[model samples]
Target: FVDVLNTMLDDTLPLTPPEWPEWGNPIESAKDFRTILSYSPYDNVAAKDYPAILAMGGLTDPRVTYWEPAKWIARLRATMRGGGPVLLRTNMGAGHGGASGRFNRLDEVAIVYAFALWAVGMAEKAEV
Candidate 1:
């Protein structure tokens, strides 16, 4: 996988000590632990509504499991009454980490760029 990622970035990816271990390795620092455990995104039933975007992968992810993200997405979908876009772009091939290993996704990136432009436009028009 190093070869794959190196080809894309034209350099090696960093090997920093992960704040959260993906493979259940021993954590060496207090910064590595979340103070809260098992808090779902929509657990606060009395809170005001908020839109969300949930991106996840199904494999190689122990930190944010595929089910957790899916459940969070479902919760947002169930509670979001205003039809906000909870864009869940699943990188199933990329596993628990971010996407890589394809120039074909240039098109996907372009589409996301266009969507962002449109969103900014909508926001601007709403303010005016």
Candidate 2:
């Protein structure tokens, strides 16, 4: 949480106008911590059954560090009651947008699509 907050403060905040109410400094709001905690997906996770989750991260993603998803999946695996095949796929050579070439991008998209199909129990139907 701190890392994400710091990133937003240091990286994203500068790009936005300070006077923008919606994008105002997080520390300036008294409800900042509470509000962020309330809506945070990581903080809200509980020991309950979940559908298959396919978390993909890029090595060079500026907006979100790869470890965030890695840690989230770790937590989910540790506490989830059942009903999941939580998976994490880290791209060794990609960034936020993914692989560089057009064909490489298509390959990445195909992988995600295949995961979605398998998650929903449609992998067999997708056979070519």
Candidate 3:
């Protein structure tokens, strides 16, 4: 996000001009830069306990780059003292929504559901 803002501020990125109205020009405005910096997840990493995480990154997701999740997980692992696992699954051949078919999505859902059950000590119940 910071990189994006910098590129946009320099008028290098295509979305800078059109997106200026919505996000403002961070390069020109300190307030805009601060606001963007405040909410950027990549910049706010801390050494604290977090819930079991299942972060998914898409190779083709234009909205959120795949490296974001990978970087986040690495940060979490390095900072977190101990807790439930922080997992990441990259879709090698998919985009933001993962694989295209209903069955494929269900597989993703099943993974999340099973993780949730295990997190709450309900995995056996789910099996039953």
Candidate 4:
């Protein structure tokens, strides 16, 4: 979400001015820009153990470009002390909502559910 600001701050993006109310105008308000940075996940990565993360993104997602997740996962890997793998699954052919077909979305849901189970240590119990 925060990475989108890079584009939002740039005038070339579609809704830069409209986002000022919500995200603050980086160009116009230094205070607001600092505030946004204070809470931005990309900027807050710390050197400590973090929970398992499954950061997924769509290649064609207009809401968030695929690079956002890719960069986030990279930062996590670099800064984290010890944690479960930070996985990234980019849907090369999809957009923000993921694959178009009903069955394909189910498949995506199943993957997310499985990841949740694994994150909570439930997968091993269920496998028995």
Which candidate tops lDDT? Answer: 4
- List model 1 lDDT by residue over 1-128, tens digit each: 11111122221224423422442212333332222111224343222455434344445454444555565566677766664566565566555444455674564566466556555564342342
**What is candidate 2's lDDT per residue for 44-105, written digit by digit as tens?**
77999999888888898755678878888898899999998888888988887888899999
Query: In candidate 2, residue 96 scores what lDDT?
Result: 79
Q: Which regions of candidate 2 fall more than 4 Å away from where they truly are?
A: 1-26, 125-128
Query: What's each prediction's TM-score?
Result: 0.47, 0.78, 0.76, 0.89
CA displacement after TM-score superposition, residue 53 of candidate 2 (Å): 0.2
If both were scored by lDDT, which would come out higher, candidate 2 or candidate 4?
4
* Residue pairs whose backbone atoms clash in candidate 4: none
Q: Candidate 4: list runs displaced more than 4 Å.
A: 2-5, 125-128
Clashing pairs in 1: none
For each candidate in turn, give its C-alpha RMSD to the true structure in angstroms: 10.4, 4.0, 3.6, 2.3
lDDT of each: 0.43, 0.71, 0.72, 0.82
Model 4 TM-score, all chains together: 0.89
In terms of lDDT, model 3 sits at: 0.72
lDDT of 3 by residue, 11-39 (tens): 65455677877877787789988887676
Give the number of colliding residue pairs in candidate 1: 0
Worst 10 residues of 3 by lDDT: 1-10
